[model samples]
Target: MSSFQNDTAHFAGLTEKQTATARLLAEGFTAKEIAARLTISESAATKRIEALRQKFGGITKNELARLAREEFSGSPSSHTVKVFEKNRDFSRAPDGEKLTWKNFDLPNTDGFRNSMPRNRPETELNFSDGFTLDATPPWRARREERLVPEVLDGEHAAPARWAYVVGAAIGMAILLLVLLAVADALGNLA
Candidate 1:
Protein backbone atom coordinates (compact mmCIF):
# COMPACT_ATOMS: atom_id res chain seq x y z
CA MET A 1 0.00 0.00 0.00
CA SER A 2 1.12 3.62 -0.70
CA SER A 3 1.91 5.86 2.31
CA PHE A 4 -1.06 8.08 1.22
CA GLN A 5 -3.51 5.09 1.32
CA ASN A 6 -4.20 5.35 5.06
CA ASP A 7 -3.40 9.07 5.30
CA THR A 8 -6.39 11.36 5.88
CA ALA A 9 -4.12 13.84 7.76
CA HIS A 10 -3.03 15.53 4.51
CA PHE A 11 -6.63 16.75 3.85
CA ALA A 12 -6.98 18.39 7.30
CA GLY A 13 -4.99 21.56 6.40
CA LEU A 14 -6.66 22.18 3.00
CA THR A 15 -8.91 25.21 2.51
CA GLU A 16 -12.40 24.71 1.01
CA LYS A 17 -11.23 26.05 -2.41
CA GLN A 18 -8.30 23.66 -2.49
CA THR A 19 -10.55 20.76 -1.45
CA ALA A 20 -12.95 21.57 -4.32
CA THR A 21 -10.02 21.73 -6.79
CA ALA A 22 -8.79 18.38 -5.49
CA ARG A 23 -12.27 16.88 -5.92
CA LEU A 24 -12.40 18.05 -9.56
CA LEU A 25 -8.85 16.78 -10.19
CA ALA A 26 -9.86 13.41 -8.69
CA GLU A 27 -12.74 13.22 -11.21
CA GLY A 28 -10.23 13.35 -14.14
CA PHE A 29 -10.54 17.09 -14.95
CA THR A 30 -7.57 19.04 -16.41
CA ALA A 31 -6.47 22.24 -14.59
CA LYS A 32 -7.90 24.37 -17.43
CA GLU A 33 -11.28 22.63 -17.14
CA ILE A 34 -11.14 22.95 -13.32
CA ALA A 35 -10.58 26.72 -13.74
CA ALA A 36 -13.71 26.98 -15.93
CA ARG A 37 -15.77 24.90 -13.43
CA LEU A 38 -14.52 26.98 -10.45
CA THR A 39 -15.03 30.30 -12.35
CA ILE A 40 -11.36 31.18 -11.69
CA SER A 41 -8.44 31.96 -14.02
CA GLU A 42 -6.33 28.99 -15.25
CA SER A 43 -3.25 30.38 -13.44
CA ALA A 44 -5.26 30.54 -10.18
CA ALA A 45 -6.38 26.90 -10.63
CA THR A 46 -2.75 25.83 -11.40
CA LYS A 47 -1.56 27.74 -8.31
CA ARG A 48 -4.13 25.93 -6.15
CA ILE A 49 -2.97 22.55 -7.56
CA GLU A 50 0.67 23.54 -6.94
CA ALA A 51 -0.25 24.53 -3.37
CA LEU A 52 -1.91 21.13 -2.96
CA ARG A 53 1.27 19.46 -4.32
CA GLN A 54 3.44 21.25 -1.75
CA LYS A 55 1.05 20.33 1.05
CA PHE A 56 1.10 16.67 -0.04
CA GLY A 57 4.90 16.31 0.48
CA GLY A 58 6.03 17.84 -2.84
CA ILE A 59 4.46 15.12 -5.01
CA THR A 60 3.87 15.35 -8.80
CA LYS A 61 0.43 16.45 -10.11
CA ASN A 62 -0.31 12.93 -11.38
CA GLU A 63 0.38 11.51 -7.91
CA LEU A 64 -1.75 14.29 -6.43
CA ALA A 65 -4.56 13.24 -8.79
CA ARG A 66 -4.15 9.61 -7.73
CA LEU A 67 -4.22 10.65 -4.05
CA ALA A 68 -7.34 12.75 -4.70
CA ARG A 69 -9.07 9.80 -6.40
CA GLU A 70 -8.28 7.57 -3.42
CA GLU A 71 -9.33 10.27 -0.92
CA PHE A 72 -12.71 10.66 -2.62
CA SER A 73 -13.00 7.13 -4.03
CA GLY A 74 -15.69 6.06 -1.51
CA SER A 75 -18.06 9.00 -2.28
CA PRO A 76 -20.24 9.12 -5.44
CA SER A 77 -18.90 11.34 -8.24
CA SER A 78 -21.41 13.12 -10.62
CA HIS A 79 -19.19 12.37 -13.69
CA THR A 80 -19.57 8.57 -13.24
CA VAL A 81 -21.66 7.20 -16.11
CA LYS A 82 -24.67 4.93 -15.34
CA VAL A 83 -25.50 2.00 -17.61
CA PHE A 84 -28.58 2.48 -19.83
CA GLU A 85 -30.61 -0.29 -21.52
CA LYS A 86 -29.70 -0.95 -25.16
CA ASN A 87 -33.33 -0.87 -26.41
CA ARG A 88 -34.30 2.35 -24.58
CA ASP A 89 -34.13 5.91 -25.96
CA PHE A 90 -33.38 7.78 -22.69
CA SER A 91 -33.69 11.29 -24.14
CA ARG A 92 -37.27 10.86 -25.39
CA ALA A 93 -40.37 10.30 -23.23
CA PRO A 94 -41.41 6.64 -23.35
CA ASP A 95 -45.14 7.31 -23.96
CA GLY A 96 -44.91 10.62 -25.85
CA GLU A 97 -45.92 10.92 -29.56
CA LYS A 98 -44.83 13.63 -32.03
CA LEU A 99 -47.25 16.60 -31.93
CA THR A 100 -48.17 19.03 -34.74
CA TRP A 101 -50.96 21.64 -35.14
CA LYS A 102 -53.08 18.99 -36.88
CA ASN A 103 -53.16 16.97 -33.65
CA PHE A 104 -55.37 19.69 -32.05
CA ASP A 105 -57.54 20.10 -35.21
CA LEU A 106 -56.71 23.86 -35.15
CA PRO A 107 -58.10 26.02 -37.96
CA ASN A 108 -55.50 27.27 -40.46
CA THR A 109 -56.02 31.04 -40.00
CA ASP A 110 -53.01 32.07 -42.11
CA GLY A 111 -53.79 35.26 -44.10
CA PHE A 112 -57.08 36.04 -42.28
CA ARG A 113 -55.27 37.48 -39.17
CA ASN A 114 -56.45 41.06 -39.84
CA SER A 115 -60.10 39.91 -40.10
CA MET A 116 -60.00 38.77 -36.45
CA PRO A 117 -61.15 41.42 -33.92
CA ARG A 118 -58.12 43.05 -32.27
CA ASN A 119 -60.05 43.63 -29.01
CA ARG A 120 -62.91 41.73 -27.41
CA PRO A 121 -66.38 43.27 -28.03
CA GLU A 122 -66.97 43.45 -24.23
CA THR A 123 -63.83 45.59 -23.67
CA GLU A 124 -64.67 49.14 -22.47
CA LEU A 125 -61.58 51.00 -23.79
CA ASN A 126 -59.47 50.04 -26.82
CA PHE A 127 -57.40 52.76 -28.56
CA SER A 128 -57.22 52.42 -32.39
CA ASP A 129 -53.41 52.82 -32.14
CA GLY A 130 -53.25 49.47 -30.20
CA PHE A 131 -53.09 50.65 -26.58
CA THR A 132 -55.24 48.61 -24.15
CA LEU A 133 -55.62 51.16 -21.37
CA ASP A 134 -58.39 49.27 -19.49
CA ALA A 135 -58.09 47.11 -16.34
CA THR A 136 -58.71 43.47 -17.30
CA PRO A 137 -55.02 42.60 -16.84
CA PRO A 138 -54.04 45.53 -14.58
CA TRP A 139 -50.27 44.85 -14.61
CA ARG A 140 -49.76 45.64 -18.31
CA ALA A 141 -51.64 48.99 -18.11
CA ARG A 142 -49.80 49.80 -14.84
CA ARG A 143 -46.45 49.08 -16.60
CA GLU A 144 -47.41 51.53 -19.40
CA GLU A 145 -48.43 54.12 -16.77
CA ARG A 146 -45.04 53.77 -15.06
CA LEU A 147 -43.20 54.32 -18.39
CA VAL A 148 -44.83 57.79 -18.81
CA PRO A 149 -43.88 60.68 -16.49
CA GLU A 150 -46.84 62.67 -15.08
CA VAL A 151 -47.17 66.34 -16.17
CA LEU A 152 -47.39 68.52 -13.04
CA ASP A 153 -49.97 71.31 -13.59
CA GLY A 154 -51.49 72.27 -10.21
CA GLU A 155 -50.55 73.66 -6.72
CA HIS A 156 -47.79 70.97 -6.44
CA ALA A 157 -46.09 72.20 -9.67
CA ALA A 158 -44.34 75.21 -8.03
CA PRO A 159 -42.71 73.02 -5.32
CA ALA A 160 -41.64 70.45 -7.98
CA ARG A 161 -40.19 73.23 -10.17
CA TRP A 162 -38.22 74.64 -7.22
CA ALA A 163 -36.95 71.12 -6.37
CA TYR A 164 -35.68 70.62 -9.98
CA VAL A 165 -33.89 74.00 -9.92
CA VAL A 166 -32.20 73.19 -6.59
CA GLY A 167 -31.12 69.72 -7.89
CA ALA A 168 -29.64 71.28 -11.09
CA ALA A 169 -27.72 73.87 -9.04
CA ILE A 170 -26.23 71.16 -6.78
CA GLY A 171 -25.25 69.00 -9.82
CA MET A 172 -23.54 71.95 -11.58
CA ALA A 173 -21.66 72.85 -8.39
CA ILE A 174 -20.38 69.25 -8.03
CA LEU A 175 -19.35 69.17 -11.74
CA LEU A 176 -17.47 72.55 -11.35
CA LEU A 177 -15.64 71.25 -8.22
CA VAL A 178 -14.53 68.04 -10.01
CA LEU A 179 -13.25 70.00 -13.04
CA LEU A 180 -11.29 72.38 -10.75
CA ALA A 181 -9.73 69.42 -8.87
CA VAL A 182 -8.71 67.76 -12.16
CA ALA A 183 -7.21 71.01 -13.47
CA ASP A 184 -5.23 71.50 -10.22
CA ALA A 185 -3.87 67.93 -10.44
CA LEU A 186 -2.88 68.46 -14.12
CA GLY A 187 -1.13 71.80 -13.27
CA ASN A 188 0.79 70.09 -10.42
CA LEU A 189 1.85 67.27 -12.78
CA ALA A 190 3.43 69.73 -15.31
Candidate 2:
Protein backbone atom coordinates (compact mmCIF):
# COMPACT_ATOMS: atom_id res chain seq x y z
CA MET A 1 0.00 0.00 0.00
CA SER A 2 1.10 3.65 -0.49
CA SER A 3 2.46 5.66 2.50
CA PHE A 4 -0.56 8.01 2.41
CA GLN A 5 -2.99 5.07 2.48
CA ASN A 6 -0.96 3.40 5.24
CA ASP A 7 -0.98 6.60 7.37
CA THR A 8 -4.71 7.09 6.85
CA ALA A 9 -5.36 3.45 7.70
CA HIS A 10 -3.66 3.96 11.12
CA PHE A 11 -6.30 6.59 12.04
CA ALA A 12 -9.26 4.69 10.54
CA GLY A 13 -10.65 3.96 14.04
CA LEU A 14 -10.83 7.64 15.13
CA THR A 15 -14.30 9.19 15.29
CA GLU A 16 -15.24 12.08 12.97
CA LYS A 17 -14.81 14.62 15.79
CA GLN A 18 -11.52 13.08 16.85
CA THR A 19 -10.25 13.19 13.24
CA ALA A 20 -11.32 16.83 12.92
CA THR A 21 -9.59 17.73 16.18
CA ALA A 22 -6.43 15.98 15.00
CA ARG A 23 -6.60 17.76 11.66
CA LEU A 24 -6.97 21.14 13.41
CA LEU A 25 -4.05 20.29 15.71
CA ALA A 26 -1.95 19.38 12.66
CA GLU A 27 -2.89 22.79 11.17
CA GLY A 28 -1.38 24.52 14.26
CA PHE A 29 -4.68 25.35 15.94
CA THR A 30 -4.59 25.72 19.74
CA ALA A 31 -7.21 24.02 21.89
CA LYS A 32 -9.06 27.32 22.28
CA GLU A 33 -8.95 27.93 18.51
CA ILE A 34 -10.01 24.35 17.84
CA ALA A 35 -12.92 24.77 20.27
CA ALA A 36 -13.97 27.95 18.44
CA ARG A 37 -13.64 26.24 15.04
CA LEU A 38 -15.67 23.20 16.11
CA THR A 39 -18.18 25.22 18.19
CA ILE A 40 -17.22 23.23 21.30
CA SER A 41 -15.88 24.16 24.73
CA GLU A 42 -12.13 24.53 25.18
CA SER A 43 -12.20 21.76 27.79
CA ALA A 44 -14.04 19.55 25.29
CA ALA A 45 -11.39 20.21 22.66
CA THR A 46 -8.69 19.36 25.23
CA LYS A 47 -10.52 16.14 26.05
CA ARG A 48 -10.71 15.24 22.37
CA ILE A 49 -6.97 15.89 22.03
CA GLU A 50 -6.28 13.78 25.11
CA ALA A 51 -8.45 11.04 23.65
CA LEU A 52 -6.45 11.18 20.41
CA ARG A 53 -3.23 10.97 22.37
CA GLN A 54 -4.49 7.87 24.24
CA LYS A 55 -5.81 6.30 21.04
CA PHE A 56 -2.42 6.73 19.35
CA GLY A 57 -0.71 4.63 22.04
CA GLY A 58 0.29 7.64 24.23
CA ILE A 59 2.08 9.55 21.45
CA THR A 60 2.93 13.24 21.98
CA LYS A 61 0.85 16.02 20.43
CA ASN A 62 3.61 16.84 17.91
CA GLU A 63 3.78 13.19 16.82
CA LEU A 64 0.00 13.16 16.44
CA ALA A 65 0.19 16.33 14.33
CA ARG A 66 2.85 14.67 12.15
CA LEU A 67 0.68 11.61 11.66
CA ALA A 68 -2.37 13.77 10.95
CA ARG A 69 -0.40 15.83 8.44
CA GLU A 70 0.67 12.66 6.59
CA GLU A 71 -2.90 11.34 6.69
CA PHE A 72 -4.48 14.62 5.44
CA SER A 73 -1.80 15.61 2.90
CA GLY A 74 -3.31 13.24 0.31
CA SER A 75 -6.90 14.32 1.01
CA PRO A 76 -8.25 17.55 -0.54
CA SER A 77 -9.07 19.93 2.31
CA SER A 78 -9.88 23.66 2.48
CA HIS A 79 -7.19 24.33 5.13
CA THR A 80 -4.37 26.21 3.46
CA VAL A 81 -0.85 24.99 4.26
CA LYS A 82 1.54 27.86 4.98
CA VAL A 83 5.00 27.83 3.38
CA PHE A 84 7.84 29.77 5.06
CA GLU A 85 10.91 30.90 3.13
CA LYS A 86 14.18 30.05 4.96
CA ASN A 87 16.98 32.64 5.40
CA ARG A 88 19.86 30.94 3.57
CA ASP A 89 22.30 33.90 3.40
CA PHE A 90 24.66 33.31 6.31
CA SER A 91 25.78 36.96 6.99
CA ARG A 92 26.47 37.50 3.26
CA ALA A 93 25.08 40.29 1.06
CA PRO A 94 22.24 39.53 -1.35
CA ASP A 95 24.75 39.67 -4.26
CA GLY A 96 26.83 36.86 -2.57
CA GLU A 97 29.55 39.28 -1.32
CA LYS A 98 31.08 38.34 2.05
CA LEU A 99 30.62 40.94 4.85
CA THR A 100 33.77 42.62 6.27
CA TRP A 101 34.54 44.22 9.67
CA LYS A 102 34.35 47.67 7.97
CA ASN A 103 30.61 47.03 7.37
CA PHE A 104 29.97 47.45 11.16
CA ASP A 105 31.54 51.00 11.22
CA LEU A 106 33.41 50.21 14.47
CA PRO A 107 36.07 52.40 16.09
CA ASN A 108 39.81 52.05 15.35
CA THR A 109 41.43 48.76 16.53
CA ASP A 110 45.04 50.06 16.67
CA GLY A 111 45.51 50.97 20.40
CA PHE A 112 42.61 48.78 21.61
CA ARG A 113 44.66 45.53 21.39
CA ASN A 114 47.22 46.60 24.09
CA SER A 115 45.14 48.57 26.64
CA MET A 116 47.55 47.70 29.53
CA PRO A 117 49.82 50.64 28.60
CA ARG A 118 46.93 53.16 28.98
CA ASN A 119 47.27 55.47 32.03
CA ARG A 120 44.20 56.38 34.14
CA PRO A 121 43.86 58.99 36.91
CA GLU A 122 44.18 57.59 40.44
CA THR A 123 41.14 57.90 42.86
CA GLU A 124 41.76 58.98 46.48
CA LEU A 125 39.58 59.67 49.57
CA ASN A 126 40.54 61.69 52.74
CA PHE A 127 38.91 60.98 56.14
CA SER A 128 39.65 62.56 59.52
CA ASP A 129 41.27 60.45 62.29
CA GLY A 130 39.15 58.93 65.13
CA PHE A 131 36.13 58.32 62.85
CA THR A 132 35.26 55.04 64.56
CA LEU A 133 31.68 53.71 64.12
CA ASP A 134 29.84 50.44 64.88
CA ALA A 135 29.69 47.98 61.94
CA THR A 136 25.91 47.32 62.43
CA PRO A 137 23.32 50.11 62.60
CA PRO A 138 20.91 50.26 65.59
CA TRP A 139 17.86 49.18 63.48
CA ARG A 140 19.65 46.16 61.96
CA ALA A 141 21.55 45.14 65.14
CA ARG A 142 20.97 41.62 66.47
CA ARG A 143 18.50 41.20 69.38
CA GLU A 144 21.34 40.05 71.73
CA GLU A 145 23.39 43.18 70.86
CA ARG A 146 20.47 45.54 71.66
CA LEU A 147 18.41 45.83 74.88
CA VAL A 148 14.81 47.17 74.91
CA PRO A 149 13.60 49.39 77.74
CA GLU A 150 10.84 47.86 79.93
CA VAL A 151 8.48 50.81 79.22
CA LEU A 152 8.88 50.33 75.43
CA ASP A 153 8.20 46.54 75.64
CA GLY A 154 4.70 46.84 77.19
CA GLU A 155 2.55 45.73 74.23
CA HIS A 156 2.92 45.56 70.39
CA ALA A 157 -0.12 45.22 68.08
CA ALA A 158 -0.20 44.80 64.31
CA PRO A 159 -1.21 47.89 62.27
CA ALA A 160 -3.88 46.01 60.29
CA ARG A 161 -5.35 44.02 63.25
CA TRP A 162 -8.69 45.87 63.00
CA ALA A 163 -8.84 45.28 59.20
CA TYR A 164 -8.84 41.49 59.72
CA VAL A 165 -11.65 41.70 62.29
CA VAL A 166 -13.73 43.97 60.04
CA GLY A 167 -13.15 41.63 57.06
CA ALA A 168 -14.29 38.61 59.07
CA ALA A 169 -17.43 40.44 60.24
CA ILE A 170 -18.30 41.51 56.69
CA GLY A 171 -17.67 37.98 55.35
CA MET A 172 -19.92 36.48 58.02
CA ALA A 173 -22.66 39.01 57.22
CA ILE A 174 -22.43 38.19 53.51
CA LEU A 175 -22.51 34.44 54.20
CA LEU A 176 -25.61 34.88 56.42
CA LEU A 177 -27.30 36.94 53.66
CA VAL A 178 -26.50 34.27 51.01
CA LEU A 179 -27.85 31.53 53.32
CA LEU A 180 -31.08 33.49 53.86
CA ALA A 181 -31.43 34.13 50.10
CA VAL A 182 -30.85 30.43 49.33
CA ALA A 183 -33.36 29.38 51.99
CA ASP A 184 -35.97 31.76 50.52
CA ALA A 185 -35.25 30.44 47.03
CA LEU A 186 -35.68 26.83 48.22
CA GLY A 187 -38.93 27.70 50.05
CA ASN A 188 -40.39 29.26 46.88
CA LEU A 189 -39.38 26.16 44.89
CA ALA A 190 -42.02 24.18 46.81
Q: Give per-model TM-scores.
A: 0.37, 0.37
TM-score of 2: 0.37
For residues 1-190, write the lDDT of model 1, one tens digit per residue. Answer: 1233333667666889999999999888999999999999999999999999877666667657766776677544323322223243334633222111122456778766868677677667656755666456744444344432343455587787778789999999999999999999999998
**Runs in model 2 with CA error above 4 Å?**
1-6, 75-190
What clash count goes with each model?
Answer: 0, 0
> Model 1 residue 125 lDDT?
69
- The best candidate in terms of lDDT: 1
Q: Which stretches of candidate 1 lie over 4 Å from their true place?
A: 1-6, 75-190
lDDT of 2 by residue, 1-190 (tens): 1112244455787889998998898888989999999999999999999998776666557656756775677654212232212333436544312222232557899869868646555544455778778577867747574364443344543435555568889999999999999999999999
Q: What does each candidate score in C-alpha RMSD?
A: 24.2, 25.5
